[model samples]
Target: AQELLTKISEKCFKKCIAKPSSSLDSSEQKCIAMCMDRYMDSWNLVSKAYSSRIQ
Candidate 1:
């Protein structure tokens, strides 16, 4: 879980945050939300596939 959150933060920050600021604007917030959702979805899909194969 910690690794997953860290990966999500790193990837999404790189993709969405062009500049460091005190706070995020609405667009940045939206981008981060969408990016995290997509990343988690992809992670879950891969994890399920791997688990099925290992079992």
Candidate 2:
């Protein structure tokens, strides 16, 4: 569980963080939030598609 969480965090950070700033700016924060939502949506879609194919 812990290992899986770490990997998810790493992937999300890479997708959301284009540059290393001292702190997350307002726009960056918003982008991160949206990116997270989109990532989850994509993941769910992919999982659903795979399951349907298997069935």
**Model 1: how far is 16 from its true place, Å?**
0.6
Instruction: Flag regions of model 1 displaced more than 4 Å.
Output: none
Writing each residue's lDDT as its tens digit, candidate 2 over 1-55 gives 5764575677778977888899988887777778767767877899999999999
Model 1 residue 52 distance off true place after TM-score fit, in angstroms = 3.4
**TM of each candidate vs. truth:** 0.81, 0.75
Runs of candidate 2 with Cα error greater than 4 angstroms are 1-8
Clashing pairs in 1: none
Best by lDDT: 1
lDDT string for model 1 (1-55, tens) is 9999999999999999998899999999999999999999999999999999999
Q: Which ten residues in a row have the lowest lDDT in candidate 2?
A: 1-10
Residue 27 lDDT (model 1): 94
